[model samples]
Target: MSHDPSGHPAHLGRPGHSGHPGRPARIADVAALAGVSIGTASKALNDTGQLRTETRARVKAAAEQLGFVGDARARALSSGRSYTVGMVTTDSFGRFTMPVLLGAEDALSAGEVMVLVADTRDDHVREAHYLRSLVSRGVDGIIVTGRSADARPPIEVPVPVPVVYALTPSTSDADVSVTLDDAAGAAAAATHVLGLGRRRVAVVTGPVTARSAELRAAGARSVLGDRMTGEPLFGDWSERWGRRAVDQLDRTHGRVDAVVCGNDQIARGVCDRLRETGRSVPADVAVTGYDDWDVVALASRPPLTTVDMRLDELGRIAGRSLLELVAGGRPASTAVTPTLVVRESTAGA
Candidate 1:
């Protein structure tokens, strides 16, 4: 018969086997079978207390033998933590929030903590209600996330637990936050375009009042220096704006070699306009975009060389930071690094 390294028969803890027959095993059963008290069994399972290694091993063996699936409540009580986090976001169903939420969920779930998510829809009253509900349920901590990279007012929660912000940064320097580096993303796209031997690059993007648009325009200018074709064309974040900018650039600039857009949607419109104007992508005007939002980038003609926001990684870091804060560690604000996702759009010019 095969045995575990501990000299216990391997079959003892295998599935379809239980120390007590015909009933689900409980912590009490594990304790009774191991000749330890219920408290001791819990501490052993939780890796707490002053129990000897052999005694802890005995408890573990008993738990496996009884097939005891631990109760989260019992585990939480012993550890003085609920093993749960409240994920509150204002940008529900938006592309940005979804990735951050999923990333945070990934980290929390792996650490044996459950996530309870709620959308505030930018409603302060509703947000207050949800915050109270989460605290009342005894969540160990909370993660507040939203749609923009711009700093916003701090969430006021009376609870004595850590709060981590993602996507939308907290204006307060004291709070831990994980946010995107939009300038870096834009600069990366510019660097790639410049590398393709395309000078006289034109900028097309969202409204100048928007933080993202301003940052991206500044970043592109920073990289291109005097090589910039003209002033950035600011418009709404839409394909129509991209299309209109094409006509404007053609009429004014006369001979543009490249275009760097704020988002994939604009990039697609830019490519469409080039094709309509009998200009081949890469050959006529090398194009680049930001946000590597796959749907638009992949479907574009000849595809687009874009900058990936890497927001999933940002979310993961935010999740880890919340976990650390709950465990009494200090995690500082983090800026996610953006990388280039090269394709045929900027192949050459």
Candidate 2:
């Protein structure tokens, strides 16, 4: 076993298998092995260095030989900083939310910060409870994720740490926010149909209360102008809604040449209904959707062309913002630009 200048056995490779009963080496053991004071060893290992270079190296060498891993909990407690961040999200856990969480985790992990997560299921009481619990736990920062910008988070209590909101607009004064550019995404969809020479355009959207749906509708109307006909159909975020919207479109506007759906699911429903009614896609009618769900788009009869909201980028930005707040930086907000992904669905054949 390699020993530093001191007599303590350096159990580098050889397990301290022999009789000297390898009492788990502690800071004292490292100090003794390095022939340095315990305080010096602690400071050197923690990088709180006031110690000489030679002393720091010797202490580090001793720790390496002993396979010492510092206890983060103990360090945190002693320093009065938990080094943890709390992430509070809506209960739905949709595919969109997953990427956002991944981005936040990646950023926090890179900074050596720990994260604790909670889901509120959009329940007001549960949201309050989770927020209070996080504050009580001494988390250094918080990230609140909501389903949309119009969501009203129920956290009424004041938080002691910095808080950042992602994929949602902040209703509170303390939070820094990041959100998707929904109006732009929707307008792009409408403009695409117009470019294809489709004079009659209609919208099939999710529940009116959903901020994304509202913004998308606004964008569509802005591009289509007064000549655009038919009342916007509103329904749940499901394939059934998509199918029903198509039937409604046919009933109300027999000459409809294009439709913009709230999401890929709705677009798929519209496509199925259109084919059943004997309409040739893009040849007779072009359809567009949002969320760019690859599986559905790839498998569709003509494949679906949808908007990619850049969800992964949204997550990455949210994560970066939270870290900045935790590092004593001012709260900052960001808006993610949506991209249009053209596929076979809307291609004129």
Taking all chains together, each candidate's TM-score versus the true structure is 0.88, 0.87
For model 2, what is the C-alpha lDDT against the true structure? Answer: 0.79
Q: What is the lDDT of residue 42 in candidate 2?
A: 96
Please report how far candidate 1 places residue 87 from its true position, in Å: 1.2
Q: Write the per-residue lDDT of candidate 2 for residues 14-111, one digit (tens) a residue.
A: 33321135655677777766777889999999889677888898888888777677677788889777888888888465777777788888877887
Clashes of each: 0, 0
Worst 10-residue lDDT window for candidate 2 reads: 11-20
lDDT of 2 at 59: 88
Specify the highest-lDDT model's number: 1
Instruction: Output the TM-score of candidate 2.
Output: 0.87
